[model samples]
Target: MFRNTKMRLGGVNILLLTIVISLIVLYRSTSYCLCKVSPVEEAFGQPMKSQPRPDSGEHRVTCHIPGLESRKQFYQYFTEKEYKCENLRWFGSRDGRKAVCMDMEFYLVPQDCHVLSFGINNEWSFDDKFGAMGCKVYSFDPTMGKADHQRSQNVQFFRLGISNIKGQRKVGMGSRFDFFEVDRYVNILERLGLTNTTIDYLKLDVELSELEFFQDVFRNTPHLLRNIKQIAVELHHGYHGKGLNKTEDITDDSSDMSPISTYQIFWQYFHELRCHGFKLFHARRNGRWTEAVWGNI
Candidate 1:
């Protein structure tokens, strides 16, 4: 009887060991499968799909050509062509303030995404929506009355401005009389320890300063352009807008190019952006300016 009891105890121990080993193997396989799934897929339990390109039978306009001089030509070139983004979606305001391509590779792993939003004049809808989408957003606006603080769980607000050059420079907040100190885009990135990080989305609404900022990026730091995935900028043309009247001419850094009007510079900037592999995906008219979104092709 003693021998039988001892044998039974040994059998129970062996069964428990086998069960533990099998459970460990099952857990490891389950973890491996989970790791293979992307965050978007995990959230939906399926691959994120996009709509097929609409067969509108419309001939798409060719971009990056020179000699877009006239206002009519510029308007036609920008308005006629819309790049086919399969998963294009509007975020933020109900009026379609911001457009983001959801099918991009960056959206697959949204937790690792980062956005740099410039020129938020108290409109937090864009930043807030992006933050809620699991992207870490860094919003900068020197004109906003609030100081640098955490705007939300994932949004960080800074009292900085995008410029061509580094260091503090006075920029018009609302009018010619109201001015605030601002910093350069590269300088701000360095300050925020994001010089090497890939920017998933870059939102620029710096009034007329975008022209100078684009010149600086294309001329000096063209390499930085490679690290950016998407760009949404509000392009201001002519002298009718508030920023055109308040902000100074952006000639401080454009010594290489010949003298040109803001109209010519605007087209030139679009050309340069096209040369750098960015294609216009969306464009919307907002009063006197146009809000254009470009995706890296």
Candidate 2:
């Protein structure tokens, strides 16, 4: 009897040791390697020989290149400044919404809030200059109140989230919402009768959990992810969403959000952005909510 009990305890210890080793191996294996930079990555770096900085003190490029990419140039310009958010200024802001500050890199305009925020968060406010460049903003918040959002001769707003994906249940305020949607943001653009539209810049702060919606739906629609000339993403972990439901192997790191740590989801998202012509020009200092910009910075 004594011998049998000892054997059982030893076996349990060995099995636990094996499980620990397996987890360690799995954790080390998922690290990602950066891909070859896109054409945008290449073009962003060449010396800006022809275009000079504007005298108005605002930095913006309106030139169109058939495959024009200048991410490297943007990198060199900002790297010289040590990737500090305060020193960089290419995007503009009119209201609080379009401020393009150290954290939120966007055009700010509080007066025309609905142009981007569909009145879901009364706390949501954009200064008078957000989306002034005619970027159509949508929200699917069912709690959105009815209001007349007038165009400033350029901007457009919608009272629903970009329900571009059709047939997905719109759960708002503990109820179901419905609308036949498209697979991409561009589809939402088309459904809203803006088929020939183009989004020059895009901001997605829809909670880090919405990555699965992006994976299942946004990715399918080529234009929404690819069309935007600029992006500002807020990375978060342990924010539950669709991808987690599908992948049981998903890691939860709420206790730690460091990139050098368990950063598989972060890696996958950034990898997708880089593949789609976004190359990091500038990112905030470590552990802060970074507002990194890619494209013709």
Question: RMSD, each candidate, Å?
Answer: 14.5, 23.0
Q: With candidate 1 superimposed using the best TM-score fit, by how many Å does residue 210's alpha carbon deviate from the native?
A: 0.6
Candidate 1 Cα errors over 4 Å, as ranges: 1-65, 80-82, 94-96, 105-108, 240-259
Tell me the TM-score of each prediction against the true structure.
Answer: 0.69, 0.45
Candidate 1 whole-model C-alpha lDDT, 0 to 1: 0.72
Q: What is the lDDT of residue 198 in candidate 2?
A: 40
Positional deviation of residue 148's Cα in model 1 after best superposition, in angstroms: 0.8
Q: Model 2, which residues run further than 4 Å from truth?
A: 1-87, 90-120, 123-127, 131-143, 151-154, 167-184, 193-196, 216-219, 240-263, 284-291
> lDDT (CA) for every model shown?
0.72, 0.41
The candidate scoring highest on lDDT is 1
For 168-248, candidate 1 gives per-residue lDDT tens digits of 665653354245666666567777777778898999888777876887666545656767888998876654335434343
